[model samples]
Target: MLKIISNQDFDTFAQNAKDAPRKRSHHNLHEQLDAGVQRLFISTEPETYMRPHRHSEEHKWELFLVLKGQLDLLIFDDEGNVTERHSLSPETNRAIEIPPGTWHGYACMQSGTVGLEIKEGAYIPTPQEDFAPWSPAEGEDGANDYRDWMSTAQPNTK
Candidate 1:
């Protein structure tokens, strides 16, 4: 079956993200969790907080392409300092590739933000050891504040 990705898919994802408790949603394109390559469309609202994390597996480099709205991809150092920040939007910077073992997270800059994420995987979720020790976990008291800071975080800053 040929699955054509259309505008309607994005619209539905956006609506789902708005309704989700975490303010984000994912629609997997890959048929199964064990698929060699994982692909998905991620929809996120401005309030969504993606806790900083990394894929420790050697082959897990990830790519994200913004298809709608905007977001700021924040790359961090081991000590939790922002090492790089890339603002992505369909009209400007559109994509980013994060290497495996790199600490990173993103903050949605606009509502209805949608992006395509692709990575080498068996779709294993990030493990506890891969979550940045210096960052707050999702739903933690400082998670929102940390997410807000990421929206404007500069290189060399914590």
Candidate 2:
């Protein structure tokens, strides 16, 4: 069967994200967690906190494409210093391909922001070591501050 994603789907996703405690939600297109390739539509509100982390598995490169609203993609050095930033929106730079082992995260820049994420996977959870040691984990103290800094951080400035 063919699955269709429509504007109403996005609207519902946005609403779900808004209502969720984490301020984010995803609709998986892949039927199983062990699928060789994983694809999903993610909806995020501005307050969503995605801590900087990287996929250490050799085959885990990830791609993100903005379907609506905007997001700031932040690339970090091993020391957790900002190395690069890209603004992605439907009207402009809409997609990013992140190589495996590259430290990165996203900051939602608009309400109702939705994007498509694709990655290689057997859906292994990110090992704790893969999370940036210099960054706070989700819901930890200073996470909000780190997120605020990520919103406007620039390369070489931090």
- At residue 61, candidate 2 shows an lDDT of 98
Q: Residue 3 error for model 2, in Å?
A: 0.8
Question: Which 10 consecutive residues of model 2 have the lowest summed lDDT?
Answer: 149-158
Candidate 1 local lDDT, 65-114, one digit each (tens): 99999989998999999988899998889989999899999989999999
Residue 88 in model 1: shift from native, Å?
A: 1.1
Considering every candidate listed, which one attains the maximal lDDT? 2
How many angstroms is residue 50 displaced in model 1 relative to the true structure, after the best TM-score fit?
A: 0.4
TM-score of 2: 0.98
- The parts of candidate 1 lying over 4 Å away from their true place are none
Estimate candidate 2's alpha-carbon lDDT, on a 0 to 1 scale. 0.94
